[model samples]
Target: MLTELWNQGVRNLVEGRIVLGPGLNVFVGGNGSGKTSLLESCHVLGLGRSFRTHRLARVACSGRTEFAVAGEVQDPHHGRSRVAVEWAGQRRSRLNGQWIDGHWEIVRRLPLVAVHAGSFELLTGPPEERRRLLDWGAFYVDSGFAGEWQTWRRAHEQRNAALREQDGKLAARFETVAAAAGTRLTGMRERFTQRLAGFLCDASTAGLREGLPAQIEVSFRPGWPEAESLLEAYARSRPSDLERGFGQSGPQKADLDIRVAGRPIREASRGEQKRVLNALVVSQGLVQVASGPQGLTPLLLLDDAVAEMDETGLGGIMEAVVSLGWQCLATTVDRGWAQRTAGARPDARMFHVKQGLVTSLD
Candidate 1:
């Protein structure tokens, strides 16, 4: 659980230290009051990137060249530890006062799952978004998956560079390495997706939707023809990849196919799609908590999660959050609505944010 958070020089938030609760923590405020910034800070601390932007420099306040976010987290295995991330022209992260190499180290200490307006893309957006969801689960469930994924990404980049240079010999060598790493990456993702399917099915059956269709199905597309191996697919696509100036057939192109009653998710109504997306996000956290190694439960961040939902939908989502027994930080513009949705949980707490200031309301 996150016990405290401190931010400086981040967007509208110049300075603040928030005491967080163990369960549902809601931040209520009007738009542009830095509620989302707060959540982004947590994301930066855990993932080393802002969910709000691709460039970390964009998060720095105007006239400032640096930003920092730190948190006090208690892991069942690690006990209480201080995790800090600082960004100047570059990023530096430390865990328990010792310098760390990358974001995955922070992730292992503080596993996080986030859902926001953009998260709808998981359903209606490109395959990359769904692939990220799959990879996040795989990263947490299997410790070695991250290294394998990194290897695949590096090889994929080298292969692309070789293709762009029109170096057939170099491309072939990198392609072999890429295919080997991608095959392992694909297997890990496939296994994680299969495990998550059961949790998603259970969530749907347990009233993820009321009048809306609950028949949701999920499948993995390993980014290549199923009848052929990665090496075979790479060979088949070599000519096209050379012409296109990039490698095309590998785990880099993987996707998660979500369907509702035989119809693609894109064809579903916005409300139906949101429910399905919510189920996917929440079930992901459920899988992390239930299947992760001992003493590891993901922290969930929901940015304006209840904006479009009715009372029933809100209740169902909140129920799932409560049932998973994990910590969740949610943002809202309406305090009453936030309270009403999270009030039933004994550990739920509320805060009010105005123009970048946060005050406890619990």
Candidate 2:
């Protein structure tokens, strides 16, 4: 589990670190005291990106151009691990310790899920983003995923550049590249959806089951599957894509049409969308433990995650954390939920935040 996280030069604060244990860790405080900032630091360190904004510089504290995060993990069952992230003088990132090479390498070694307000990006962002999320998790669960994805991505980039250059000859040369990548991406995604579906479980059994027992289905929508082969689709869509100024019909843009109880989640009520996202997250944790060698105690970062979820949704999430023996760090505007969560949890730590600092209220 994450033993501790140290952060500096982040929003609204000078520096801070909080020691953590295996269950629930709650950050409670007024709006601007950096309660959420601490969580953002964890989100940034773990995922290499912040859900709140695409820009890292935006989260930097006033007068500070750099930031750092340190985390310690102990695996009594296997071993221990420690890592730190430091970024100075720019919007870019800096790692202070031995680092993993690529973005996927970092995430695979450190698989952390951050579910904050931007969680809905799953429902709303480009299909490539959603697909990558699953692929990342798949890589975490299976090491071979990265090499497959990388090989395909390289080919796709070359082909896309060729298309942009309006060099049909070059694009044709890379058709095999697009087809291979598209097929693998599609297969990986299909298997993940099926696996998550089979794990169909309710968070309520652990006393957190709420909302409609979330129904989730993942379907592939190859933009032009019926009209052409992967290469043909690229050729067919190339002219219009260049006109649109973006590649519009590739695996890079492929999407999985998600639905909750037959309702298109994007068009569903706010409450429904939140529940579906929650279910996916919880499902993600369950899959991790049940499938990997690392058996990483699923780390769930809930930044303002509950406020938008219903009582059932919140309870369900908490229940899943406890049931799966996963670790959770959540933030809230009020303590009512925290208090209730504490009461329900036998092993949970609570932290009070004020202006970028965190104090454990045990």
Candidate 3:
């Protein structure tokens, strides 16, 4: 859990710090008051990337060339650890004051599950978003998944190049490696999906929906025909891949087929969609913690996601998240709802943000 967060030159927030409570931390503010920026700062510190925009420059304060987000987290494995991310001409991250070349350590220590305005994209958006959901869970649970993903991506790139160059032998050599790594990636994805399905079907994790749908089935599509081996699929698609100038079938094309009552999620009403999304997000975190990675509890970031929800809806969601035993930081423009939420939980923490300034309301 994130115990302390401090950032400088991040978006509209010019140098702010907050000591976060372990349970539910609510930030109340009007739109554009930098409540979302605070959430984005936590995201950057945890994942080394922003959930808002792809470019780090966009997150920098106006006229500033750099931004930094640092925090102290109560890691299950490492006790208290310091993690920081800074972007000037390039991105740099530090763990406990020692600079690291990549963000892997930070991610391991502080995993994040974010639900923002664009979260609906998980249902309507392209397959990459869904694949990302699977990969995120797989990374935390399966220690070898990251290496296999990297190996497959590298070999796949090489194979695509060979196909473009019209070298059959070279293409075949890289195909062997790509297929091996891709198969392992698919296996890990399959295992993670099975575990997730069990969680989604459980009442404890998915009870927020209150029996919304009869059956919520989530299946994995391994980016190739289920019956065919990766090598066979690659051989069969070689002609098409060569003509298209890139490999067509692999984990890169994977997706999670989510359905409700044997119907696609897109057909569900807006309210139902939100409930399902919430269930999925909550289940994802539960599955991660249950996967047995010691000291690695995911931080939940809600960027006004619960806004406009009715009192019961908001209350149920809050109750569900608080039961997860994970720390959460949620923002909303509804001061009344924030107050009510904080009032109900003696351990809850509250903060107010205005024009990027944050004040603890505890």
Candidate 4:
């Protein structure tokens, strides 16, 4: 869990630091008052990227050329370790004031799960979003999953290039590598999905006030025929691959099917969808805490979470977050929500933001 957070020139947030509580930390202010920016800073420190924007430079405040976010994590065995991200023309990360190779070092120590306004995209958006979420879990639980994922991606790219050149021999070679790695990737994802389903149901039962349907089922689509091995599937799809100048099927096209009751989550009501997304976030955190490496607790970032829900639903989500006993940084425009959440946990902390200034409210 994060013990202290500091940021400079990030979005509209004033250069400042906040001592974070291990349980719940809520930032409250009106829209455009920098509430979300504070949460984004925590996201940056944890993930080395912005949940609101793709370009890191955009996180800089108006007319600023760069931004930096740093934080201290409470390591049970090591005491406290510092992680920082600084971006000007290029990105750099530091661990304990020493330069690190990449953000993965920080990610490994401070994995985070975010549920925001765009979280609904998990259901309404394309397959990549869902796939990304799935891989995040697999990356933490299955040690070999990341290396194999990169290997498969490289082989898949090579196979596509070979097919584009109409080189059957080269394509076949890369296909063998891709198939081997892809098959393993599929297995890991399948197992992670199975675990996610159980956690999702648990989170819904505990987090959603309105409650989910009688049955919640989560399934994985491996992006290929279930009957054929990946190698065989590659051979079967070779014709279409050559015609299109790209591989026709692979794990890159994988998706998740989240069914509430008997129907897809897309068919659910707005309030139901928001609650479901919150539950999914909680479930992902639970999966990580249960299976991740020792002493590494994933942080939860909620930006105006459960926006479509009433007070009852929001309180339910808050209750679930507090119960997790992990670090949570949440934002809200509603003061009531902040107060209620702060009251739920004796260790909870609250901060108010206005015009880029942050003031802690004990």
Candidate 5:
């Protein structure tokens, strides 16, 4: 679903152009070359966020007005949608040749899955990381879910601050909104996990650890005592909450507990966590395309995520990827993997990237 990418002054990329095909697209590059930056550019152009440490404004050339990425997509091919993300100085962007109100709208078109070293955080980091894992799945399945998510987050913040400030009256009123929003967010999380777990069960799927007997499951639990209404819980926890300067209840404190084989991923072997991460990303992308907006499946972006896999692991992952007919952009340091993957599929396209330049190897 990515027509082409014309990146101008973004991160390591001084100015690089890439024209993509429908199947697997690989970017092969060495260390500081911009391999990851290209993938991050895809994400920023499509999602409005940078994957690396660079600031959004810095994504453009060091001192330029801003960086711009222009490309096309499926469904009513509207020529090229260009996004010029400016530093705080300029402060604006355009989509589909027309000026847009908010930058997020520009990001909807950029649905990318970038797995790098940080993926370890999925299992080793705080619960927020895991919560986000589930939410990405939810966002793909439910269109209105994002708006609900935003509302819930805002309400949660208001309620938490109120409770922290010891304003019982304000916290109580805010609790009403928070409670309603939490329930909705909780339900969405549940729905996404359910769909994801079911998809992994598909025999044609790839990347999951075979014979891992147990399945991937996610559950939501609030931080404090289980109460039917949040207002009641907040009232009960107020004394201690104010003592701690943070709300002890609601989605702010919610946790997404994920278990594979009846054992937590945090406790699982390092390899197991990697396999689980792969499985989750692959399965979610497949389902999103089958049932995302216009049923347009997402284009998978693996920024050097695969080179870490051994031969067998890579085989299983690629087999599933090919079987599902998903469009992908895989980055790697190994030229052999690039050769093999692109060689096997006639539609696959490969690019050689070094420093900041990109050249199609196909």
Candidate 6:
């Protein structure tokens, strides 16, 4: 659980400190009061990225050259530790008051899952989003996944460079390395997806919305022909690869195809998409807890959860979070809604945000 969060020079927030509860914490404020920025800070600190945007520079407050977020986290196995991330000309992270080489170190200490208004993109957006979701789960469950993924990424980059240079020998050499690494990466992803499918199935059976079918199917496309080996696919596509100046077939192109009642979920209504995404994210947290060795419960950051979800949908998501024993931080604009959602829970905490100021109302 995250016990403390401090942010400086982040968006509209010049500086703020929040002490969070172990269960649900709600942030209520009007539009542009920096409610979402607070959630973004936590996402950056935990995942080393933002759910709203990919540009780190954009997160820095106006007229500020740098931004920083620090958290005091208590893990079941690792105990309490101080983790902080700073971004100026470059990004840097520290653990237990000592500087670390990479952001993954901070991420490993504090695992997080986020569902924002745009979370429906996981179902309707591009394949890269789904790939990221899959990889995040694989990274948490499989210790060796990071190294393997990095190796495959490096090899893929090298092969692309070789292709651009028209270096046949070099490209072939790197292709061999890429094929081997991609094969292993794909295998791990397949196994992880299988485990996640079970969780998704259970969530679907439980029903995310009323009158919805329970037949949600998740299929994995390995980015190559199923009948041919990666090596063979690479050889088969080498000419097109050279023309395209990049590797077009491998784990890089993998996608998670989701369908309901034999139709792509993307074609569903907006409300239905939101419900599916909520289930997908919550189920992801459940899968991680069940599969992780440290018994780590992921912290869920939900931005504008009240606005993005209907009452029944929001209630179901909250119920799942509580039942799974995961910590959640949700932002809303309505104080009544916040109170209604959180007031009954003994462990729940609420905060009011106005023009970047945060006041606790527990």
Task: State which candidate, 2 or 6, has the greater TM-score.
Answer: 6
Q: Candidate 6: what lDDT? A: 0.85
Q: What TM-score does candidate 6 reach? A: 0.97
Question: What TM-score goes with each of the models?
Answer: 0.96, 0.87, 0.96, 0.93, 0.88, 0.97
Off by over 4 Å in 4: 77-79
Error of 6 at 342 (Å): 1.7
User: Model-by-model lDDT, in order?
Assistant: 0.85, 0.69, 0.85, 0.83, 0.70, 0.85
lDDT of 5 by residue, 76-169 (tens): 2233355554445554667767777756555456556656777677767887667766667667677777787788778878877887787867
* Candidate 1: worst-modelled 10 consecutive residues by lDDT: 203-212
What local lDDT score does residue 64 receive in model 4, on the 0 to 100 scale? Answer: 93
lDDT of 3 by residue, 31-56 (tens): 99999999999988988888788798
* Stretches of candidate 5 exceeding 4 Å from the true structure: 54-66, 76-86, 89-93, 101-108, 211-214, 222-227, 293-295
Q: Which ten residues in a row have the lowest lDDT in candidate 4?
A: 203-212
TM-score of 1: 0.96
* Better-scoring candidate (TM-score), 3 or 5: 3
Candidate 1: lDDT over CA atoms?
0.85
lDDT of 6 at 52: 82
Which ranges of candidate 6 are over 4 A from the true structure?
203-210
Q: What C-alpha lDDT does candidate 2 achieve relative to the native structure?
A: 0.69
In the range 8-74, model 4's lDDT, one tens digit per residue, is 9998888888888888888898899998888888888888778778789999998999999998987
Q: List the residue pairs that clash in candidate 4.
A: none
* Candidate 1: tens digits of C-alpha lDDT, residues 22-94: 8899999999998999999999998888888889999999898999999998888788899999999999999
Against the hidden true structure, what lDDT does model 5 obtain?
0.70
Where model 1 places Cα greater than 4 Å from the true spot, the runs are 203-205
* Candidate 5 weakest lDDT stretch, 10 residues: 75-84
